[model samples]
Target chain A: MKPACKSCTKEHEKTNYLHMKQQIIEILTELRPEFDFTQDVDFIEAGMLDSFDVIMLVNTLDEKLGISIDGMDVVPENFSSAEKIEALLKKNGVK
Target chain B: MSLKFTYHNKRICGILTVLPQREVLFEEEMDNYNFSPAKSMKLKLAMGFNKHRIVDENTNVSDLAVFGINYLLNNQLIKKEDISALILVTQSPEHFLPATSNIIQGKADLGTDMLCMDINQGCGGFVIGLMQAYSLLEQQEIKKVLLINADVLSHKVSKRDRNSYPLVGDAACLTVVERSETPETIHAVVNMDGRGASAIQIPAGGFKMPGTPETAEVKEDENGNFRSLENLVMKGDEVFNFVQTKVPPMIEELLKIAGKTTDEIDYYFFHQPNKFMLNKLADKIGVPREKMPSNVVENFGNASGATIPTAVSFNLGDVALTHSYEVCFSGFGIGLTWAAIVQKLEKLKFNEIIYY
Candidate 1:
């Protein structure tokens, strides 16, 4: 198999990031179907996510994404929004 | 670091969980929380907080244990004379000096030939207590071990503390562990991290921080939950993370060591912190939701170390009385300690949940 060129690698990375972002949104929506996670709002501050929800989110992310999230990264901040959760997944070495 | 052990010819012959008669519904206490109705309801649904059994304010750990043991004795489920050792595991001992086990021994009037000792442990205490029972049975003179796990921790949790109050429950489980002539291999594993001790603890009332008036001063945490130093404080997120990150691997390791696959085990009677956590843990470990019943918390609250036995007696009481199953009992929390036991439970002489 030939290694990807620089432009090809960049394109692949962009696609992966977009796919990861979509997955995060779907997870957040599934967790609390009533909440609109697409909006750029703080889930924690808006009472959309509590500590228990954060733990559930982490568990789902770990299972769905096939990534082991660091316990230290399970704080409310990391799960306050889909964008933040996506960043957390990326930090955990997700594609 | 995991402490692994395998014991032979030991079995848990009986289990009786005594729950208080009083039941407090989560909706009744919803007004006590600092959150809105909708938010609190979400928490209630997520955490499986329906109702929990709590002892009267005047009750203590020894009281519950005495009641449970007396029930066992009166019903002839356990013979008092056969009990060679009395082991009481709890974080809510009646007195610091006399040892609650001795107090129970004296109150129950079990003969003086038995060894009475107390172990301070929380959720993981049941498995730890079983470990101790197995060790004691190793002695030639010892025959039956009366392992009582009781905690009236509801007394220690502030009613206003939304984080710990609604979930804390009081219950006692008296299990009779005895030597079995039938050959059996009981595999167990225990792992602890003291650094996470504060993850689930009552910060004061020990010698390190004696009970002072100031320690009893109720204060609000950042999350708006009210608690004092003397009350039980649980850092929920940290404990959840601990369970999620550590427990599945521990179970896998134990199954591996025991040369058994996940499907080989009949049931996973783990400590019921909450339904959500237990369900997540079951998912993580590939155990079916039905196999790992997480209804204990919703029904009787999280009874600390007693949860495992409570789970068994509550869910499998009728069937377990005459049937046999290869079960895995795991408990985690309060010492930041996690432990598991894999053994065959067969035809228990007594397996039921009685109300105090």
Candidate 2:
């Protein structure tokens, strides 16, 4: 099989990141339907996400994305927003 | 490391959970949290925090154990003379010198011939206590073991601390383990990570961190929960992560060692941390929601090591007394420990919950 060219690989990475971002938003929305997860706001500061919700989100991400998130990375910062959660997933080698 | 073992001719004959009559609702403790009512209510819904049983300041572990032991003895559900060993598992001990099990032995008049010891453990104490009982039953002389798991953690939890107080409960579970002639095979496993010992603990009151006036000073944590060094402190995220990552694998290992599948198990009577944690765990482990009862914490609070047996008695009390089932009992927490036991529990002589 021929290796992908640099430009194609970059485009693929961007597409994967966007897909993960959308999935994260969907998961967060399911967890707390009342919250507007689409907005780029700090879920923790807004009182939309608590410890229980964070744990639930971690479990859901692990199940849906097939990634094992390290316990050390379960801090509030990683789960404070959808973009942060996508970054966390990438850090966990989600793609 | 996972410590796996198997036993023959051993069975858990009965379980009785004694809960304090006092009940405190989450609605009443809403003001304790720094979060707004709306946020706290959302948490209450997610965590399944309705009410929990708590003991008064005067009540202790021994009080509940004595009451339960006497109940079994007076009701003739168990003969006092048949008890070969008494194991009291608790994080809250009445004194530092003499063992709390000795105190219960004296109070319950359980006779001097049997062995008496105290195991300082938390949530994983129930399964650990049962393992100890099975070990005692290995001896030819030992016939039956009376394992008591009780904790009065409410006294150690700061009421103003929303994280721990609302979920903290005071209860005792008295389980009867005996040597059965039916040659039943029981598989058990225990795994511990001492590195996470501080995840759930009271910083003071122990020999290492003796309780001082300074330790009693209340301070607010970043999460807005208030507690003293002497009070129970739980890093919610750390503990939740530990359970989510570690427990399901431990349960899988247990089922594999036992040569059984999830479908073969009748119930997963686990330590009730809360509804949210348990629901996530059930989903991860591929177990049906009905099989794993998470209502114990909401109805009776998280009684540390006592939650496993309390879950069993509360949910299976009536049917378990008359029918046999292949049950899995698991507990994870405190010692940063997680343990499980899979066996056929046959027609318990008594399985019930009583209010103290």
Candidate 3:
């Protein structure tokens, strides 16, 4: 059911980190149109985003991507942009 | 002024580092963590979080600090031996006795002789760390300061703690502040509440409550239970009321002190707390969305004290720091604390003069 990592035993993580980031941004944009979708917009002011969105995002990344994100790593700085979020996944060797 | 003499200077820097973070256990193709009913209804409703980062049990924050500081230093040609002061701020230290900064210095491959210490401020830690560096630099004792805001919120975090699960996010931030006569300087207004200190505090493992059966078994109200004891708890309405009433006035006072107006400042970075609060504050204070810098709440979930500097580092690339333009900042939360700092960003070339 999961593509386990030979070293860390993490699952098919990267495949989903990429897919969900776009999907979530699309979801967020549809929910709130005023946000500058071209770049990373502040969650609260953008209307559809908030703190819980990150949790949901982590869950989304996990369920869709299969990488178990460490709680300590789930910070705002990492998630500010699709680029940063994707970069974080790559830096961790998660994807 | 008798004579202008420059002494060995102390400055502060910041770095934000994070490790691999994902849920510990989850197996799903398209399932969403947001739909889980176990999470706090308010947390889910107010900001809409479902899954937050889960740092591994073995991973302490000092490692993250090392990663962050190394990354920041990799770009600049600076050696570790140049550092004079290092302040590590974290709620979770590597050990009960040894300061966490010592471990960070050891791992980051630094030379000996650093004034390393640990700070115990809950979330206002990063700002306090900045203030500490500022004081030292002003005294011209140390040459540089590393203000590391790193924390691992997993070991103490309860999976069953719905209230805190969505709210408390983790991260490591490092900032490098060097001595500058005409560089960006911070002017801050800081406040703390020791009376309401017990409002958000650890209930176990300390001299006051000493992790023993007789002392530990005392008062199982809403802490450390299977039902709702694991997560951080806050009287939201009380905290909200306090911030709304106090923060705006504080900003007004800070503006007066700096002799500037909302219109005069180039960039204003609020804590970027939540959508609801941001909306209210923006309306009340007249801080246009353009002036505010944030990648706020719903994005990274709340990185606690790391929010302010995180906003700056993430967004400042686009900001052209001109001599005429100045930056204004504010940080608030936990320990029921908040701070406002205003300063001018000076030119980077001020140090380059051909001396005879």
- For TM-score, the strongest prediction is 1
Instruction: Assess each prediction's global lDDT (C-alpha) against the native.
Output: 0.88, 0.88, 0.58
**DockQ scores of the candidates:** 0.24, 0.20, 0.03
Tens digit of per-residue lDDT, candidate 3, span B1-356: 01111223323333343533554222221122323343344334444353444556677687667766676567563557678888887888778878888888888878677788898765667667777777766645677877777667656644444344444556676766677655444557887666666556555566665565553232323333232233345544345455666677777777777678988888777775554455445545667857775444454445566666655655653232323347776766677787776765443211110100
At residue B45, give the lDDT of candidate 2: 71
Give one digit per residue, the lDDT tens place, for model 2 in B283-302: 77888979999998888899
TM-score for each model = 0.88, 0.87, 0.64
Q: For model 1, report DockQ.
A: 0.24
Candidate 3 chain B weakest ten by summed lDDT: B347-356
Ranking by DockQ: 1, 2, 3
Off by over 4 Å in 1: A1-50, A53-77, A86-95
Give per-residue CA lDDT, model 3, range A1-95, as digits (tens): 54455643333455565575677577545434556555656554544344455555655554465555544455556666667666766665554
B212, model 2: CA deviation in Å?
1.8
Q: Comparing 1 and 3 by lDDT, which wins?
A: 1
Candidate 3 wrongly placed segments (more than 4 Å): A1-95, B1-45, B48-51, B183-185, B211-231, B318-325, B345-356
